[model samples]
Target: MRTPTRFKAGAVILSAVALTVTACGTGGGDTSGGATADAGSGTGEIKVWGHQGEEGEVAALQAAVAGFNSSQKGVKATLQLIPSADYTKTVSATSPDQLPDVLEYDGPLMASFAYDKKLAPVEGLVSAQTIGNQTDSVKTQNTYQLDKKLYGVSMYDSGLGVYGNKALLDAAGVTYPKGLGDAWTADQFQTALEKLAAKDPDQKVLDVKENYGGEWPTYGFLPIVNSAGALAIKDNKAEGNLNSAPVVKAVQQFAGWRKFVDPNSDDKAFTDGRVALSWVGHWQYNPYNKALGQKLVVLPLPDFGAGTKSGQGSWAWGIGGSSKNGKAAGLFLDYLLNDSNVTAMTTANAAPPGTKTVIATDPLYKPGGPLQLFADGLSKTCGANPPTTACVATPRPVTPAYPVFSQQFSQAFLNIYKGGDAQAELDKAAKAIDQDFTDNNNYTS
Candidate 1:
């Protein structure tokens, strides 16, 4: 389990050619240049790769790998740590030799890989009941592409939440908001922010100065949009309803709260601790909690409007398509998803457990903490894959250009939040999206 930190904007560009080479098998088959029955046996080596993290973060995975190696006399497993900065590029560019028998991949990247057929289905390897029964949303994310074929297994669970400074709230004489199930409506949430800000008129509460609160406007505001019944994108199409009645109403309400908080600067608002609540992820538990010392209180993002749910994001582990050791990879994946392994990882990483059995038994989860809120939100949230067209198509093809599309969407939302002409910005973004879809032959119209 690894709590993900933000990545730098520009790192390394992955060459498609390199990816192709790495993904396809090299001509030489074995040590003797011929296919052999012991290809994946102890005489052969299996490479496994994933992002690097804190020492204890991957202990569970290491333990599981150790167990597999000790129990199976046929195979030897080797681990490779890829820096998060180049992880996506490196994974996407895997040569047959570079590709791991089993690997961990972020969910959106996994979706893209599935679209490209760079991943192999794990349908027969693990029972849907075993994985699916753990967390329906995770199962949905894992099989979100290509006719619901299982491409990966969820290693752990995580969701967005508000990391509050309890002392700050107490100092402001404000009450902590309820869990997602009992989250505050848009107006109610704003009112809380306003009250917190008013307690110290000269102090800042919410940050929006830099890039107009780019990060928060995306994650924090997403659920509000959903609660307001606005869809960011529907059926691979960008929706202008972002400025529609419900969405605009939600934004306006949020903007009002922003005014009371740091209407001018993003840094001062959050760092000053005048902001009683900061929208963040479950992975931020350690760093943020440590920053606040004993002042931290984790809570779900406040629900806005009448909706009973919130939006969520999750990650999973996927097996590379180019690997020759499918059997061994499957066994490794099975061990990773077992309740004990999942629990150990999530607990160490400060993330929520993805499986039902793990979540139920994990000691890290308190009865009414943010983990419970995430479990509740998962039941209501929608995923980006399997696409809205899955109901009509068999083995749906998610556009290979989804990452580009997501960037455009993020930019458009940024423009709107920055006080740009909302309708105009949306129209521009819609046009670009339509063009992208059409150029890729992924659009319906």
Candidate 2:
């Protein structure tokens, strides 16, 4: 059995989730504290796990749960919001029978859970047509296939969009990259970086957020490689694809930003006027809007020879493989996905909606809204392919071996940014990833 390791926001895990159809008499709902807690009043325990630490998102979820609780005389669920540090290990360490009824997990890592039978096949529980109705990006992130069985459905979605500080750009006397296009060419991007750096010799010009380790590198840097025309993994091939000449050139180009990048910088750096350009997502929109006002702009990742790309996928919900109450849990999952609840979560999180219907009505994502750029969910397979000049995202590669792929790729990026050989590091990472594919039987397609 694979050991569940801690998720550093980059790591992923697998789970099995189910719901019980039977309804027990109503009882007072109780909060589950650390380790474990009482099941409360229900047919049986329907424990739901989430990892949102923010007060706003937590309150939003609690509100949704409260609604679920009031709507039923059965299946009172306790939302055990764990700290991210303790989350993955808690889920992985618990035996199948001990696992929670439902899991709120990072979408990218759902494959690992599916591979290990942590997630029950959701195909029969939810209709194929209903699942199909989800936005392409949201659907792709939560879907996990193993021997042709899909494991789960996402409750919501989130993605990153490149953002620029117009004031900083003007200070540097450079024009912001146009939205609705494939982003700037490599030379154009470099020229902009140079201009920004030159304008503030003592201040950092770019914040690639290298200080964030683990899965972040894959999410933050993989798009650059994708835009350079490389697939982290494709057609059971890893070596050539990840180590392609174009991919290496992209890494080289990113490394070239070393002089302008500040690894030690935090999110406030961009909003505080320390950096001219950076990568952030919708969650920061409120504070960013408050900080920079009209000067803040969402942008697409600059294209290399290909097109723009950026990261996608965020927290998603799934049923545990051994939940005693599969039907009830499924119902809760469905409740969480309801338009009103989904809107509540999106509104609280300040993120793009996970489904098209929600986005259609969401004022935040409506045309001319601050988050409209990210609301598009990126064009072309969640960054799996080169997209148009449109500021849509190119999400990270989805695979059962993502944890390993992310770890190795993260290390390699660290090396390249610190003056290590780009081709050599990527080549090494690719070899390791390909071997993992073979060991895992190419995810047993």
Candidate 3:
């Protein structure tokens, strides 16, 4: 899902190659201050940066920063909005003088920056104890990291799920699957799709051309692989487990369902009232609600088997390593991550709350709502933890070279859907991924 916020201020659009910076460098030396500058005596200015998009979101962040600045007598915080697409480029290029004291970073980019030493270890500022008191999924995605170092804190959690149009199910006289308890197996899911297809052979029930990049598939289809007990990448090695018996069976099942999906359809295939269900993220709540004008029933993505490790995804906040006012920035980070602030951000973003406390109490999470079901699924079935490296075994990676990786994965999947050999395409893609890690010195093994 697109972050509702983006960088405002002056934005400089760049060609695909060169890194770009937005705001002109404001002349000011680093104002050195103690890490524990008392709120009453802390006298310095701290600049905060984040993606600027939705007006309400930007205003909310600005208000939070303002509250922090006003709550203290000694320090002031300045807010700088950056466009989401250009944030990484701007953050990477800016010197200490121009970078913000604190930043809201995309989770996937955190590892790349941390690996490059562009971000500071936040362990000293926030403790596991503090995070533990928040949401389980939020803490799991944020605190768990590569090399056992805590580099980011998540403000919201997002995951993929099947959004069923209850009206469509009712019209077709099909019973909506129970929560995760009755989650369908791969065959069951395909059977349901085939039934839906047969019910209206003239129309599609799902869209097959949707992008499978990153967590969308992890949330939508990885559970199938996991249920099959298929190993994606074990011990940092490429495993063609995708071609293994269980996985192959799952893939074949998916291909069967493709018959009922219109290859040319877009998300509107469901959102525009053309299909029975759509694979989407929790963040799509607002747009979906706005379009449907009623609550959509969400079902736990069906499992391929009886596996316990369901894949999930998250977005996090990180601090820049080059910031001169590291302490002030850390303080601001702590404040923004407080339970209340995290809940506010997650709710505003229309995503699942990261903390357990909020998940238990957020009004949006009614007992039978889709959000609550997602939260339960997260608690019972999410994977061990996300990989700290740039690329993962399945879906894709979050490295600096993600553009190239995504392009390759997209092409390979398109080929597979068009009658190309799944093994051949995956093998070719795996070799490319291995080469990417080797060439970039990202391979750990």
Candidate 4:
């Protein structure tokens, strides 16, 4: 959750590797002692694994683990941090019995692990209140519950929006949106871009982060497809849905904005004042706020016919399916989701809190707060269904085939943004995704 750029490759590779690796069944063994004993037991140690994130992230996580370890007795918790680049490889290579009792994973990849039976259901194990308190978007991300069962949970969630320079917009006679409800229409947005470009020294009005090229295109631009009332997948397939008229039209409109975009190769277009608007995530808040101070303003992405939409979901926690200490692991999860801990993690990451209580109290996300638009957008997620006009926050497709879907869609975005044929590239992407889903038998056993 530090940023998509850090761990995208590992997650992409994890799913492909998972499909080839033999599915491992539930069992128990000790990671430290190598003993044939249940680590999930009340008295045994609970080993936790998480991605080594940014400096603040690492410090916050260590503090949380330390707090949990000292809070009580009986079950001791130890955390092991894996470098982001190697997190997936380590999980793929480890034997199930040797895997940590508590594992941290990206939200979208939960389906791949749940389908492989690598994670256990969290419903009865974690408290009813804990699960119930999570944001609707969090529930959608964590649950492999299309079968009606819970699996994973996260401390915080991710979102996307437009960051505008107030002075720049004002000087250009451009009106910025107050919130999601008043988000600019596609034409209005394009007009604003043109106006801002005229005022900008470099004539680059937007930074869509073309440099952070892994899972970002899918995370940041899928809203363009979703806002147009189109989806990348439906009924477990991508053929007709992805290559449909609305999707192509939406993508074409996005490509039309290419001339105003800053290549952002050096990643300083927005921060350095070369660009007036940056289409990015919450992780950029501190830097953007620091640079502009009173001039920085956050707004929802433009409405693309249907409504203003954004993407949601981030790193979450789960109990390993093979751990015998489900109760102990659940306790740790419950501890992590408590208001204080949730605030700690979300504050460190500058992400939206997973729980309602923290969001209500958080200065950055409370009503009329600078980042409230993100919370409002996340509260109206489309869940596992296709998005509609009313849906504003759409999670990535919840399917084991997501890795393939993301890869293909991202490549199509790059090609289309570079002036490739939108329809042709999307059709090629749709076919490749469908082939992967077919090869896996729609991921249905």
Each prediction's total of clashing residue pairs, residues at least 3 apart in sequence or on different chains, is 8, 33, 16, 2
* Model 3: per-residue Cα lDDT at residue 201: 55
Error of 2 at 341 (Å): 1.3
| Per-residue lDDT of candidate 1, residues 1-445 (tens digit) | 1111341111112334423332232322211111111124323567788776545656767887787678767667788878754676676665534567777766544445655445667765556566565566666556643355667777665566566778777876777666554555555666667677767666556543333321233443555555565555555566564445666666555544545545533334444566677665555556665567667775655554545334343456766666677766666676667777776677777666777777766655546553566555565445543212111101111344445544555577666666766566666766776666565445221
Off by over 4 Å in 4: 1-40
Whole-structure CA lDDT of model 1? 0.55
Q: Note the Cα lDDT for every prediction shown.
A: 0.55, 0.66, 0.54, 0.78
Off by over 4 Å in 2: 1-44, 127-133, 145-149, 264-266, 377-392
Best by lDDT: 4
**Residue 118 error, candidate 2, Å:** 0.1
Error of 3 at 256 (Å): 3.7
Clash count for candidate 4 is 2
Per-residue CA lDDT of model 4 for 216-306, tens digit only, reads 8788898888888877788777888888888898889989998999988888887888888999887788788888999999999988888
Alpha-carbon RMSD, each predicted model = 7.1, 8.3, 6.9, 4.6
What TM-score against the true fold does each predicted structure earn? 0.78, 0.85, 0.78, 0.92
Which of the predicted structures, 2 or 3, would earn the higher lDDT when compared with the native? 2
- Candidate that beats the other on TM-score, 1 or 3, i.e. the better one: 3
Ranking by lDDT: 4, 2, 1, 3
Per-residue accuracy of model 3 over 1-445 as CA lDDT, tens digit each: 3321221111112223322121111112111111121222224887777876466656667777777887776667788887755665676565544555567665544444554445666666555555565555544444323454566676656555677877877777767676666666666777677667767756588753253333232234544555566544443333464345666565556655666775432446666777787765565666677777664777656566543233444556666666666656667776776666766675666666656666677666647664676666556533343322121212223343343343344455556656777777667766765565565544221
> How does residue 19 of candidate 2 score in lDDT?
7
